[model samples]
Target chain A: MDYFLVSFFLIQYIRTSLQTAVNHPEWEKRLVFARYFSIAWIATFYIAEEPFWTNWVWDIFLVWLIVVIYRNEVFNSLRTTAQTVMPFVAISIIRDFVKGIFPKFYEENDSFFQVAVAFAFVLCFFVWFYARKQMKVLQKEREDRLREEQASRAQKESLEYLVNERTQELTMQKEELQRTIEELKSTQNQLIQSEKMASLGELTAGIAHEIQNPLNFVNNFSEVSAELCTELEEEIEKSELAEEDKDYIKQIIADLNQNQQKITHHGKRADSIVKGMLQHSRLSSGEKEPVEINALADEYMRLAYHGLRAKDKEFNAALVTDFDDTIGKVNVLPQDLGRVFLNLFTNAFYAVAEKKRKLAAEGFSSDYKPEVKISTKKFANKLYIRVTDNGTGMPEHVKAKIFQPFFTTKPTGQGTGLGLSMSYDIITNGHGGVLDVESIPGERTEFRITIPVSEPISQS
Target chain B: MKILVVDDEEDVKSLFEQKFRKEIRSGQFQFSFSFSGEEALTYLAAHPSEVVMILSDINMPGMSGIELLKTIRRDHPSAPPQVMMITAYGDSANHDQAMQLGADDFLTKPVNFVELKEKLLTIL
Candidate 1:
């Protein structure tokens, strides 16, 4: 009995220590230790008696109860109760039957059986506690994972919404910007066309005045030729011709030849003036080529001066030409620049001419003969040409808008103002150069054209 | 002096009439009218002495003024009538060509009659 009790206590101590290590209640181990200890004590009595009463043998039920009730690895309540009470009932029946054969060991109290039943309750509690602890830990982990998943999903949805909204805003802004650019371009083209018409109008008025001068000479010459032809014919018919008369007839012939030559010279000049006006009014294809700037300037300048002079024969201006010897040839579209220079020269002429017109109109005979100075020079990396005119100089307001399209002070249908604007486009926009103008009223109006020395990329 | 005006548009001829109103009334000038190159040639072949100069437009439908000027230069090498271009086509090519093709001068439309008259006087 002592040894059995000691063994039970040892098992109880180990189980209690292990349960404590698991951080669980140790009451189940204590209960199991007490039940097993009772079984061992009862068995010791049977052993000490040597053929102990069969009623004492009922103590063997303890081992069977432990094994059967613990089939689930936790004590089973129904099985433990069966092991304690049902076995006792069977022992009681056996004792009842054996009592008739041998009278002594038959009387058994039920309290021991009840005590075994109480152990079953403790075992059930231990089993429930163990299972509940394991389940609770697993449930907590599952809930935590679910919370993390929900949080991540919310972040993903909000981020996607933000991205979608930003894209929409960018698209709207792009559409608005495109619309504004289109509007600006349309207005710009409109202004350009208007300026073109204005300058064209001015040229037409100037051209009409230019062609009349030569025709007067033709009229006068023919009148003189008709009178001389009659005189020569009558003199030849006189039948008595003197040497002086023959000489006089020859003088008439010489006069006729001189008149014919006059008609020839002025007629060609008139034709060229009209041609220049037409060239200025025509549209350009704007193609580029390797061109001589100096010759180009001379040809157009002469034509422009003639065109202006042809309109008013007495509007004489001193033309000073300075050509840059080192200014190498550059490739350009002649038509484009021809019109540009024409505009600049003619505008210079107009400024001076306007002053001349006003002076004549105002009855000021003081000859403030106008002067136009044109010169080309080689600046670093560029060719700079300046056209300075002593004209009725522009006020600040007019100077500020010199290149603005369609803004001209001339009478309507007189100045299609596209000249300087077109020149601006050619020098700065097309060739990557600069066009600048400076003016002092009644003193000088100067236009500086800076073009790259090297040929423009498009021309090249 | 004789001045020959060549243009496809009859309006231009009448416009010239309006421009030279005084000259026509004076009967000091006798104007010959030829609508086509063949007609102008026939008039020229018969009355070459009366025609002092030809003022022709460039962009006619057929047998252009340049071609006519070339023919006149080729056929009448000596004392060929002065030919002046009077048209709207005044590009560099045309400018260079009219001078090259024996045209004494060139002008562009719409004709400034005052300039036209002076040019006529210079050659007539």
Candidate 2:
């Protein structure tokens, strides 16, 4: 009976140890060794006929092995083990106490005690099974939650990357569209300007023709009348008349002569203006010829100066020129280049004249001497022409648009606004040159033209 | 020398008459006036070989001086009268066209009477 009792206890210990090894695969080897040790201790107990204290020592050793196996969850595993074994342990102690108290009754009901022990073992097995099922459910829930979080984080990262990529593509497309729009706008402006120039040319030609005919009549008639007056004076001198009457007739003829002179002077002025208009209307032949740049520049400078003076008698500005003598002649379209120079000179004079007028209005004209300067230089296969003016210079905004067609600082009807724009085209497109302007507000303004000396001029 | 003056402006007749008064009085040159290119053509047809020179103004109504010169060159290739073109526009295009069409001379207005007189004397 004693061997059976020890064997039943050893079987229970081995089953629990194997259950722990199965539950924790990582602790399998240690748990298996513990099972063997428990079995060996039970064998020692039987072979040595050890006292009951030896059985207690083996039970403590088995509990210590369980504690070691569940080291990370020692208290939880201890409580679970206690819950599983407590009923069995309490039932065994009660049986031992009953047997001691009533030896004859315990012997008569030994079978009942065996049934109670088996019932306790079944209860402990159910408790252990329930606790393992609860642990499995908890572990499964935690793993599912972690997987879901990882999947959502990956999706969010992918979505963010897609958004950034789309934003970059949109920005690039917007920039391209803006560039195309700017190109279209510039092309449209160029077309409008060319059309305007064409119509203006025709108008100028018609007006010049009509005005030149009448101007010719005025000039010829005045000249003829002046000659007739001289002939009449000779006739009156030869005639026999009173000295006082002769003097009176002579004074009348003199006044008439002076009147004809004035008419002739104004008529010639009108003639020149008409010629200038015709020149403007004439189309360029697009022929490059060798021309003295200095002489051409000087002529246009005088023309621009006289043109301004004719409009405003009081308008005057000092004109200075520094020509590069070594640059004797350069190949260029003379008329087109002359037009560029005339435009630049006219703009310079206008700037200085405006400044002078403003200063005069402010009573500061006495100290201010309005000046326009033009200079030329030659350096290593390039020619430079600069026109500078001491005037009310332009601000940044105004200077930026000065070369745009129809952009002008002058009041309406005073400027056509095409002078500089056309000049810029002629120098750059026609002659393969560069035109640039620099200005400081309230100080000075300068326009510089750079052209390759030996560049073969294209017919633009 | 008989010179036919062709112009659109009617006032041109009086102006020319006055300007060449001395020459007209002295009979050194005889001047015939026509207000249009058609009238000049008619005059030339009526008095063929009588008119020695045509001082024609370009840019006239109905027929331009270039057309007139072309017509004269074609009609009287053997004995084409001297045709001088006068224009307000002294552009090289017209000048070159006139010269190419057998124009005797090209002059720009306002015409210098002194230079014209000298040129006429040289022609004479």
Candidate 3:
């Protein structure tokens, strides 16, 4: 490249030297500048320059220079071109009429200054081209960084949203669970209260029955005493004079005996009622023994009938019994099972008594008396005792709840409301038997208690 | 008729002892009592025909009144006392069993004198 540039500048100098006789002084000074400048410019002008002849000559020279030179630099075409073309122009004029590719002769015969300016112009072009490419690469990197930052921000926002939703759902579930717990607690409390009330009701019923017993005795004895007095007065009023009153004395004696028997009978019933209440309502200290069904049924039926009559003195319900002669004996606590029978009798009487009352109010007389029919039927393994009453029977609803605790169709205070509930407990729970009812409204109500007559109730 | 009142409660016996003392002294009727079912059985075994009617408590510590009645019915059905089971427990299971055991009648506790007199009249 330096040789080419020197040749180029020599041509230019020749053109100038041949320019119609320029002065010797101008030529000499111009020759000195052109000779070394061209060589120097050509030596360094390899990056942006294309060649006119044997293009690799300057590359060989550049290789030598690069091997020895320790210049740290970017590709600065303008500086390289000036460094290479400077010596070419200077050497061109000093060489003895050398012919080379400066081509100022054909390159519009431009002056040496114009050629140097063109080399500098090409250097500027390469620098600008590379600078634009570097700026484009930096822009692409910045765009990718923005996209990554945006994606991270989107992910963080979505995660926060999910956390918020899940927290709200958990809180709602906790509230529902707490509400269910509260409801369960309230239900348990209600059950406890119901049990306490049931026990209390049983206590009160016992007390009422006991108090009524003594009242019964007092009433009967007093009446008997009055009747005896009247009879004595009648005996005194009988005339026929005192001579042979011996036979008459026997008559008075018999009447006196009858009245005495009545007095004793009434007094004993009152005593027995008190005894029964004391026994049943107090501590359970009765002996468990094998008892005969016929006797037990008869006695409990009478006791239970009296209990019902004690409540309503005007009640006049007839009792009918059809005992099974085959059933033998059963082992049980007489007091407990006796109470169950008593309750059944009382309930039957209530049902019949109600019918009687209603019938009487509707103008029916004693022609159609209410009857409580108690019958026993023996089956394979158990004995069935049915107590039925001709009464205003239960409706479907009442029948369904009849065995539930404290359920009653009677007037509020007239019943402890535990009669059927406790009866169910005794017959079913205590005896391991079934207490069932069949009823038809305005017709009859029947309660059938099927119990194992041969089995020990204690095991039950 | 002579009456035998059998019960476990002292008050029941005492009430009768007091109420019937006058009539007993006058030779109108005989009235007696035994606390336990065993004693009642012992008394009845000796005085079988003496007892025209027996008022017995259904519940007792040993040998309940119903059991005594059963023995009476089995051993001496013809001369047996007309038993009336008196009790407080008004449950149907025992009442049904008692009546089924040959008990002539039943009486619940806290008794009414009027009803008792009528029932006695019917039995007599």
Candidate 4:
């Protein structure tokens, strides 16, 4: 009975040890050793009992335990099982033989055997609890480490995104800064150009003033001489002189007249040049007069045409006018407006004449007639004058700089280059108007003047 | 007609004399030249009866034509000669100012000798 009780307890211990081993992989080796030792003790107890049925039951239980361990995948190698179980099996079998030789001594050590089994049960319980607690801590640590890794990855991605955005923003700012720098540089150049023009205007004004005195003397003396020559010729014709002497005197008079005409023509040219420089330097004259716009335009048109014809006998262009009769008197500086009209008309004629000369040179018989057209329109509070020429129109680049002082396409002595600039100043600065040019290369160029018809602006 | 021509430019005397040679030769007119306003005033004080007309350039070195006109108007208030102001610039301010200072006529340079002769004929 005692052996049976010990064997049953041992069987229970072995079953619990095997279950613990299966549950805790970290403690599998130690728990499997305990389970095998308990199994060997149970087998020894059953073998000592000598009950055939109990022995068979124990054997079947052992086989079932092995099957359960195998199913749990914790069953160690056979050598390890033999090492843990064979020693205990050998010890218990020896104990049973000793009891068979000395039954009294074996009976007396039965309590010690029970105590060792109880101690073994306590040790297995302690080991199983310790292993379960250790496994819980290790699982918590692993979960925490995985969470930390995920957080660090997200932080790194956010930092990279921020750096990328900052780089893009910096690039945009740099481009904007570069553009602003270029704008400032251009403005500085324009300012310098204007400053240079201002100084040149002053210098030219002084030079023109100095030239005016001498020019006035030449023109006046030439006229006086011409008048004297006429008087002398009349007196000579009335006098009683030899036929040969009279003929000689007539020849001299003819020569004098021709020379006088040449002198007057060149003097007038000088006078016009001096006038241009003066007008460029002079501020707007503080005088406004009632001027007939149509008549003024017409007069200047004729003057420019005749003036060009006088210079170049070959220069001819058809002049066309479409004046608005309703456009009456406008209060302005007549001299300045006359100059503006004359400049536009002269430029128009020059353009047409040049194109005609070019066509003649090229031997083109194409009926490409050169023409200059003048048109004026009157509004309620403004006047518009349009001058158009079908000639060698200016390219875009030349047209852009046409109004700058000292900028001209004509030969140096032919043009003072201040005509359009002075006209621009007169119309815009002096008369509160606008001068605009439109052109297509090789087709035509048109200049439009728009002047306000309000209360006369006080001159500065 | 006897005229006093006042100008800063010495060449103006020959210009005027040459332009009016016919009239001068015919003894229809006598002309005197003064280089400045002071000289003209002195010539006027000396021969006031001979100078029936005074043509003066408005821009002069010491005293301007307008000043001479004012002085003549002040001194010879009742029997003042016909005073004409000539200027190189046709500025309206100078014209108006000379007119206000008792000038009889105003002309811009270079003066039209024929128009001047006609004007002188009318004045004389």
TM-score of 2: 0.57
Pitting candidate 2 against candidate 3, the one with the higher TM-score is 2
1 or 3, greater by lDDT: 1
Per model, state how many residue pairs clash: 23, 0, 80, 0
Candidate 2: residue A234 lDDT (0-100)? 98
For each candidate in turn, give its C-alpha RMSD to the true structure in angstroms: 18.0, 11.8, 20.7, 12.1
Model 4: per-residue Cα lDDT over A27-65, one tens digit each:
456545645665666677657775434444444444444
lDDT of 3 at B115: 78
Residues A184-214, model 1: lDDT tens digits: 7655665666766666667784664455434
Give the docking tier of candidate 1: incorrect
Instruction: Judge candidate 3 at residue A426 and give its lDDT.
Output: 74
- Could you tell me the TM-score of candidate 3? 0.37
Q: What is the lDDT of residue A129 in candidate 1?
A: 58
Per-residue accuracy of model 3 over A1-460 as CA lDDT, tens digit each: 3355434543353444335135445545544554454465565455446443433444344333332222423212224433543443333332212225445553554455446545543443454445547657987888898899899989988998998899899999999999999756655554555566558758755775657655655654555555555565566567565745745775666677677667767766766655555556554454557767767878888887887778778878787999887765776567677777787888788888888788889997567778888898778878788888888888999899888765667754556566778778877766778999999998899998887756533322
Pairwise DockQ winner, candidates 1 and 3: 3
| Candidate 3 lDDT (Cα, 0 to 1) | 0.67
* Candidate 4 residue-wise lDDT, B25-101, digit = tens: 99989999999999998999898677899999988889988899999999998788999999888878899999998
* Superior by DockQ: candidate 1 or candidate 4: 4
Misplaced by over 4 Å in model 3 are A1-142, A206-460, B89-96, B114-124
What lDDT would each prediction earn against the true structure? 0.68, 0.82, 0.67, 0.79
Model 4 CA lDDT for position A234:
90
In TM-score terms, which candidate is top?
2
